[model samples]
Target: ILSAVDTFGFHLNALDLRQNSESFEAVLDELFAAAGVTAPDAGYASLDESAKRELLVAELTSARPLVFPWSQDFSADTERELGIFRAAAQAVELLGPGVVPHCIVSMTGTVSDILEPMVLLKEVGIISFNPAQQRLVGSVDIAPLFETIEDLKAGAEILQELWEVDLYRGYLRGREDVQEVVLGYSDSNKDGGYLSANWALYDAQLAIVKACDTHGIGLRFSHGRGGAVGRGGGPTYDAILAQPEGAVRGSVRITEQGEVISARYGTASTARRHLEAFVAGTLEASLLDTESLKEPERAYGIMRDIASLAGEKYAQLVRDDSGFIDYFTQSTPLHEIGDLNMGSRPTARKQTESIGDLRAIPWVLSWSQSRVNLPGWFGVGTGIMRWAGEDETRWQDLRKLYQAWPFFRSVLDNMAQVMGKASMNLAQIYSTLVDDPTVSQRVFNTILDEYELTKEVFFRITGHDSLMAGNERLERSVQRRYPYLLPLNAIQIELLRRYRAGEDTFLVSKTIQVTMNGLATGLRTSG
Candidate 1:
């Protein structure tokens, strides 16, 4: 029974020499020693000596895989150098014998120079291109950014050239090599519009998959998905099932982000259920019906175009709006979130006073706290409503897409859940935080109007009045806990007002933590 189940695993972080004084490699080695390699059911272990090796040779040979996260934009400082080396060394040692190492490339800081160095470290196996970096680039014309057929082909060509050359060949330090790349949805969509990021990623993955197939190299894709739809949320089963046939043929990995980690695996039973779901979903997707694959490519293209147009509109409203940032800061308790100090990383990369620099976590957190959850459904509601505006043909196509494509359907279902929990009226209570009535009215009204339209569309599509329609337990749970959570929001706002007034840390830290705990408990996910 244990062997029948796929065990759960957490992605580990290597202590970069720059980030830590302690040896991260040593720490990991210790973890491996205790945790054992290849999980018990798989019986994968990293044996140190001949006797131990002989004892386990029959049970395990290949090491469990390792996933590495690297910052592409790190400063050219001692720490950055050390971090890169530390991560690389760890992967070289830990990966193989059941370990697969992956590198996450942050597209923000030093992207132009990042790829060249990566070609030298081909043995590291997986390298990801994060579109979230475009958010930090502050580039106005972001349309030419999607990874294209030409781009993937070019990258592959570059790899082939490097493999034949001395510079990259010498740097690899003698190991067989293959590379995998990942695309991020959270940071990318948060920087770009939701639809834009989604399309860019879809296009990129499809391009890469084809490129690998043409080149006769194994291709693996890891999706950097967050907890909500706006941040790349979708149903795991359907999402995997809808993959472009061979795109996810053999292996895959995705970040289990905020709330999702707790929601899916807070307990052992839930963990088992979720793990089984992934295995089941992946297996099912690997065997999709031929009819779905036979659907005309033009049909898919039309949906992509509609999504792109809607994304453009979404970008206009959020990124282009002049005063929306001010309204975002004032209306939401975002200021306090920084004071909360919940995670290991900073909310923003620099200490600048702009929302553009803020990380996706806090951005999502702010809207969640305000009960607007603007990130999840902001542009989507408008896009969908407008999509329904043009003609019955488009609407019919969209409805059909929603019904036929598991990916599209999963997106809608996620939004439906997010929208149901969202309370624009409750969000309005915090509107006094904003001084500009026009900006407030526009932001607030736009969200409220879109919510009604979204709910209507959702009802029409699902033939259900509201989300969780048949699940009374979930609805009742939300109802009972909402009142408790509202007070936390109120307290969070008051604390933020005091902190901003130049008061000491006494109130802000305590009150913020209080609210964090309460919300984390009440909502079952932190705001």
Candidate 2:
């Protein structure tokens, strides 16, 4: 227990206080209003980008904070948020900087979004600017989480614009010129599908690196990965090594979600192994010149073609086909999974039927429970087949690329692992939960056909006749666990059947929840 406590820290890992950028802006607007400032009379949201930046810089650089003893007129939500930041400051002061190292602004689109948190931190005395000393004082890193494909594509420009601000530049100088930007894997995947998400993340990192280089600043990336292949889940070592050149200069941060945390760190030995792999991978990525492994120009073209084709196919099934959602919710134990008290975080970002609004954890977890594992490899086969069919030479080129490029190889290998875990026979069983036979048959058939194609392409590319051919230990482990998972899957299907058929008993719900947890454990993955 002491070992566990020590490993997890006083707070069970460094806490990062995060909120949408718009929330921070709202907090600031309240502060400005209480102070009787007319500059924001039209509201901060309506202000143009340049005007917002100017106001933010003025407020952040001022020795006087926006908050005062008389600033008690703010809304309850704003007060709670401010209190959270204040608590973070106090925590840092009491427990040292590691207690809360980051104040992340999610969905950060503009330069002002990055500055809004800094302004809030200054109000709580976590950050201060002294023009006389020509330096800035701060303990926490303000990280911008670029989540959408568009935000990712525009990441470098936003960072460059933020750095050009004199006050922010001073903060960077104080922090040793290192800036940490978080690339959100889950949201981007949800927004643009797997292929598009991967490519956008890579391209964003490359651009951000270039921007940092031009500005003579060191860059660090925080990867927001989940346990499923759809959410940037894969072998961590290979994933790190496959990063674009200069992306992982010396440091990297990744989020191991609750489900993955248990699987990877449930025991001392397992925890140690995972940590060692992370350190080893980071060291190798930092020191090795992986750029020489492949011709990047040629590789980039192939990847673009693959991502385009894959993204279109993914959208056709998930977004274009209206019946897919019904198939997904009915076939998987998604609703029951939400009722499980797995974590403090809410299951969905907002209450909505749209897949885009569904958080990635549940999105991937539901698929894992159903044994379809669609997020990991759904669109990949179509992408490969389309690319290869356009030109016969492309197939040979892909084989050569897989052999030569660690990035390409890692992508296919990770997909193969998820594909290996997928049991179509069991997936067929789950499909029975779908009320309409036509919808179930159509969607399941599409998924099954794609699964076969993915497996075939994956084997051909890797030159392996069987999945996990090189990893005997993993194969053996899977075989041993395979039988145990079948019972849980069977129980889940029955429970789902009864529950959907209007047998909405608490006992039935609880049993379904238990089975969901069991399957997630058996598979060593959740959302």
Q: What's the lDDT for all of these models? A: 0.56, 0.85
- Residue 17's lDDT in candidate 2: 86
Clashes of each: 13, 0
C-alpha lDDT of residue 41 in model 2: 55
What is candidate 1's lDDT per residue for 149-225, written digit by digit as tens?
23332444443443343322332322222334555566666665655566566656666566667655555666667
Model 1 misses residue 495 by how many Å? 3.6
Question: lDDT per residue, candidate 2, 1-527, as tens digits?
Answer: 89976676566668898998889888877887776653545777678899889888888767776777866667998989988988988888877777888889999999999998888888888888887876678988889999998999899999998988888898988888899999998888888877778888988998999899999999999999887788998888888988998999878998887678778899999999999999999998899886555568778888988988998888899988878988998898877777898866666767747787787788888888888888887888898888887575887898888887888887787777777788999999999889889999999999999899888888767789987886778889988999999999999899888887889999998898888878888887686
Error of 2 at 479 (Å): 2.3
Regions more than 4 Å wrong, model 1: 1-76, 83-100, 108-114, 119-178, 290-296, 351-355, 470-473, 501-505, 524-527
RMSD of 2: 2.9
lDDT of 2 at 430: 91
Query: Could you tell me how far off, in angstroms, the CA of residue 464 lies in candidate 1 after the best superposition?
Result: 2.6
Error of 2 at 58 (Å): 1.6
